[model samples]
Target: MSPSETPEVVLHDLRAGDGLPLVLVHGFPLDHRMWDEVARFLPDGLAVVAPDAPGFGDALLTESEPSIEGIADAVAEALAARGVERAVVAGMSMGGYVALALAERHPGLVAALGLVDTKSVADAPEARDNRLRIADEAERTGSVAPVRGMREALLGETSRATRPDLVAEVGAWIEEQRPEAVAWAQRAMASRPDRTAVLAAYGGPVSVVVGVEDELTPIEQAEHLVESSHDASEAALVLVPDAGHLAAVEEPEHVAGALARLHARVTR
Candidate 1:
């Protein structure tokens, strides 16, 4: 795909043996490729759908405002277009926000939810300020350098040295992204709503996963989600050792394991 070429929306459907649908959502500044690693071990006989968020990857952003709701709507549209009715939606970071929005906006569409390395609360003032600051930097610097910093921020501190291959894979993916898309996503995520209430209100099987070394969305936030989730009894928390924000990439096997277990729980 060329740098300027923007597809309406990129949807990748990987057919496993086929049972229930597992929809994977990517985080900000990234596309569906982030799930490639973990998708390998997600078990057979389950359909895996990884859609690139609008304004990211092959998915183009034709909309004026790309808020969480907008992204969720676009995803729902894409799923509908592809004949997906009910799915086990799993999201990471920015994708997590979209997942919650999806569950809220179209409850019937989600059979189960997996929130990974993301928070249920809205962006705090300080967090919003940071996103805005990054957006300003992206606007000024054309989004590449700032996004590079974002890559570092998302990965664990030790990943740079211990997991060079993972870092390289994510770095290449970041470099492949369009600058305009990154900036737009930065703005959208900055303005996203608080979804703590969404979690508390939604009565569904939810799986919350976090990385031990994830500084961005710390364990405390995961704990809060565990406490607040409506189906707390069914809410499963998997803390991956030596992993960080991007758990799927940092420890793909572990993330996949958690996802497989969640899938089984919801299906059974």
Candidate 2:
């Protein structure tokens, strides 16, 4: 892809709030709605834009290969469309991959970062193969059931044992995803490069958040993100207790608090 090429994706611009803009990127098989609860807890006077990444939610995948870099470019374009020059980019899970890509590919657009329930490493061989298999199944079946099967791994043990309602809500979101989107996202993630170097080089504030009970991208990954960043002393490492991969959804207040702090640090 050329530097001038950016995929066209839909942007949900919430024109409320006052300070610097906050761009929220959702994970695979989910849409901007994933941040609904977290958005409510954000500090007032901030502009928030949540976009549907290509091949996910309402966004269409126009690229031949939906690579993470391509999605990151799309995010930059979406932000530009909203008249936002630069903003704090926050992402979860697969979205985090795109956020890292944004910092690497479009550094001017990212003032800070909020990486939640995500990691900076590329998928291992076994994990890559597994993602391909899941993608293949989704393409063949035209259904997201295979991806949905990962709910247990995506949620924390505590959420699974106690928050049946939240689990069901998450399931509904997964079920609504288009199978093609699931396949494309799997492929995109499988092909993503290790972006720890991006964090190591970033000069702005970063918030690495994880759920204490998260099994997918565990607490260790969050700690590594903070430790590896070039500005480690400025990065904030937050652990949301009893939450899982969808920490923002499970513990919106805690996630919001982390984001608020990051915003405060950046603006100050």
Model 2, range 169-216, lDDT digits (tens) per residue? 889999988898888888889999999999999888899999998888
Number of backbone-clashing residue pairs for each candidate, in the order shown: 2, 5
Worst 10 residues of 1 by lDDT: 1-10
In order, what is each prediction's RMSD in angstroms? 3.4, 2.1
Best by lDDT: 2
| lDDT score, candidate 2 | 0.86
TM-score of each: 0.93, 0.95
Return the lDDT, model 2, position 157. Answer: 87
Error of 1 at 35 (Å): 0.6
lDDT of 1 at 159: 91
